[model samples]
Target: MSKIALFGASGTIGSRVRREALDRGHQVTAVVRDPRKITEEHPALTVVTGEVLDAASVAAVAEGHDVVVSAVGGGDGPGHQATIKPAAEVLVEGLRSLGTDAPRLIAVGGAGSLRTPDGAQVWDADGLPEFVLQIMHAHGDALDFYRTVGDVRWTCLSPAAQIEPGERTGRYRTAVDDLIVGADGQSRISAEDYAVALVDEIEDPRHVGERFTVGD
Candidate 1:
């Protein structure tokens, strides 16, 4: 089984990914600021208390793993927003310091930077809300940073326009550089299905060094 070091394990997406990974027989180290926040327990799971922004702490926990999945989210407050870039920067640096290239990194990204049918960015759509604009800008910045860093094998997986807790059908469509819309003209995917896709990718590496989107 592959060893995975997951940051932000207490978050929504991270927790789902942790469960999916463990269910697939992989060993998972859930890194979070508060250990009590994670309620689920599995034989293959180990919870560790740490900060993702701290390079030293990240490096310590990420030292020996087959893959690293970062599901950290941008906070609600204005000042706390724009966290993805900083967290990604520290994660890359921390993984590099380990002096090994075994573990590949996968980052859960946002859909704002994704392209529409007319080749326009979703974030740039007309009449977009101000709060959404802020988060999108940060996500765009984080994706941009990933594009420039070549020393590590990283993949940014952006979900559909709407993601929430739902059933795991294990059925979805994948696309690159553009948003995926269903037959109903809606762009969305269940969180469980997204986790399935992520774990599938973790087991079988594809779309490496690039960004891909998923939808139902």
Candidate 2:
């Protein structure tokens, strides 16, 4: 089982990812701003106070872990500026300080940059709210930053156009750089199944140094 250091464990996607990781027998250290926010007790889970925006904090918690998973920007969390691109920059900087002892980085990304079947990007669609457009651009900026880093082994997983807290069907389709639309002409996946896909990636390590998306 992998030893994972998880950031943003109190958020929607992060909580589900934490549960999925623990259910699969992997050890998880849930690093959050306030430790008391995580009340779930598990044999394989450890909650600790941390600041994801600080590189020193990232390095301190990231040491000795097999993989560092950041669920920031995956769900409707606050602090749009702090959660997306800046978090990505600090995470890489912190991991870089560890030298060869650093674990792989898996970060939650946005679907805005993914190309649609009709030759337009998700964010390019009409009538998106200002907040959503901001988050999408932030994720896109973070992805651009990730693409320039070659020393640190990093992977970004962008969720579908529509993702919410739903049942975990344990089944989904994957794509790289392109949006995954189902036969129903919609792009969506339950956050639980997205957690499954993430943990599966943690175990298998297939999309390293690149970004991939998931849909139901």
Q: For model 2, what is the C-alpha lDDT against the true structure? A: 0.93
lDDT of 1 at 73: 75
Cα-based lDDT at residue 64, candidate 2: 94
Model 1: residues >4 Å from true position, as ranges? Answer: 74-80
lDDT of 1 by residue, 70-116 (tens): 99974655754457789889888887787656478999999999998
lDDT score, candidate 1, position 54: 89
lDDT of each candidate versus the true structure: 0.88, 0.93
What is the per-residue lDDT of model 2 for residues 43-131, given as tens digits with 9 covering 90 to 100?
A: 89999888888999999999999999998754454457457888999999999999988999999998999999998999999998878
Where is the poorest 10-residue window by lDDT in model 1?
74-83
Model 2 segments beyond 4 Å from truth? Answer: 74-79
Itemize residue pairs with steric clashes in candidate 2.
none
Q: 88 in model 2: Cα distance from truth in Å? A: 0.3
Candidate number of the best lDDT: 2
